[model samples]
Target: MQKKIVKMFDEIAPSYDIVNRIVSFGSDKLWRKIAIKKSLKHLPKNPKILDVACGSGDMIEEWKKYTDNIIGLDPSQKMLEVARKRFPEIKFYQGLAQNLPFDDKSFDVISISFGIRNVVEIQKAIEEFARVLKKEGILLILEFTKPEKKSTIRNCIDFYSNKILPKIGGIISGNKEAYEYLPNSIQKFYTLNELCEKLNKKFEVIEAKNFKLSPASMIIAKKI
Candidate 1:
């Protein structure tokens, strides 16, 4: 599953950012800004950061506003190629979230935006996050979660994500199947509460915020 997802991302690498802007109406940037802002509150100035599953280095781009001591890890070479071209100074590694190629307590902050659900061994990945982060370090996650309940607004969101998003995203990205997997993955992913519970096992979950009219959510945690 992980290998297939990596290949899918690689195939969509060229149009990933463009399709995201169109589908999310550019709100993805706002969400990343919000997550980064919240993370800074608990982190020191110029903290060393690691962005896992850092597709196209979007979160790392946000992190660069504060510090340059950042590393990005992703499984898709094509995506990293785009990221490298965008930020030539930063080092990027091709690695899986479940197995990071780094020493223990190596980073002060670790972030994964919209990529946690892609990990097949999610708990192992969470453990790897804890292992690589220093004590009291920050963990920032921006993810799409399954809805807790049904509502009129949620139903509308479901329609857009499951039906409309694939068509528009497929048209723009030229990979309808990849866009289709987005909604299906969200449906099978953990809810906000469930994800926080998992984080709580290794970190103190400080905040979990849900965006209006969207399935995406952000989590800020501190390693315990």
Candidate 2:
């Protein structure tokens, strides 16, 4: 799964950001803004943030408004190349989330946005997120969630994500499977209660909010 993800992301590196913006109707930036603001709430006095699966460093760039001690990590070198080009001053590393290359308690805040679903070992990845964070450090995860309402809105989202998103994403990224995997993975991903259960094993949940009509969510937890 890791190899597949690396190849897929590498293949779409050149146009991933463009497709993301288009497919999200330019709401991707807004979502990142919300994640950053949420992170700031529990950020340390001299916060050092680690952004796991920091694709194209979008979250890292948004985080700069709040802190300068930022490190972006991703498994795809192609994605890191794009991130480096965009934010030359910020640090970018090619690494996996399940096995982070950092000392214990190295960061005051950790964040992953729309990337946790791709992790081959999701629990291991969460453990790693907990390991690198300082005691009481915050972990902010922004991910796609299954909507609670099962109505016209759900049907519309399903149609858009399953049928329309892949087609448009394929045309833009030239990798239809990547886009196809997007919705499929989200559908298979854990529910909010399930995720909180997993996270609570390592950290205490401070807040959990569902957005975009519960199709998107942000979970803020602190290491105990």
Candidate 3:
């Protein structure tokens, strides 16, 4: 499953960014910017950042605004290649989230945006995030979430997520399965409350918000 996911990402590497803009209507950038702000709030002047599943190193670029000690890690070598090309000075590594190749307490801030659900062993990945993060380290997650049942607003978002999004994304990226799998993954993944429960085992959930009628979410936690 992991290999298949890596291959899927590798195939979509070239079109990932553009397809994301199309699917999210550019709101993805705002989501990420908000995540960065929440993660960096009250942090020290200089904080080390690690962006796991950092496709093409978008987080690396954003983190660089505050500090230069930033690294990107992902399982797809092709994605990492794009990241390397974009920011030659920023270091990037090809690795799985479940088994990060980093020392304990290596980063003061760790973030994974819109990619956590793709992880096969999601629990292990969270554990690894806790292991490598410094005590009181920030853990920020920006991800798609399944919408709540029955509200008109949520119904519209659900229609967009399960229907309109995949259609547009598939056409743009030319890897329809990749886009189709995205909405399904979010539906099958944990709810915000359930996710916070798992996170609370190793970290304290400090801030949480729902975006786009609960179809997306942001979570900022600190290592316990």
lDDT of 1 by residue, 150-210 (tens): 8899999999999999999899888999999999999999999999998888999999988
lDDT of 2 by residue, 1-224 (tens): 79998889988999998998888888878888987787687775658889999989888878888777889999998999999999898888889999999999899999899888889898999899889998999999999877655678778878899999999999988889999998898888887778888987899999888776336788999998
**Tens-place lDDT digits, model 3, residues 157-198:** 778878888888888888789988887788798778777887
Distance from true location, Cα of 149 in model 2, Å = 5.2
Q: How many clashes would you count in candidate 1?
A: 0
lDDT of each: 0.94, 0.87, 0.86
Pairs of residues clashing in candidate 2: none
lDDT of 3 at 17: 85
Going through the candidates in the order shown, the clash numbers are 0, 0, 0
RMSD of each: 0.7, 1.3, 1.3
Looking at model 2, which ten-residue stretch has the lowest summed lDDT?
207-216
Show model 3 residue runs off by greater than 4 Å.
none
Worst 10 residues of 3 by lDDT: 142-151
**Candidate closest to the true structure, highest lDDT:** 1
Candidate 1: misplaced stretches above 4 Å?
none
Query: Candidates' TM-scores?
Result: 0.98, 0.96, 0.96
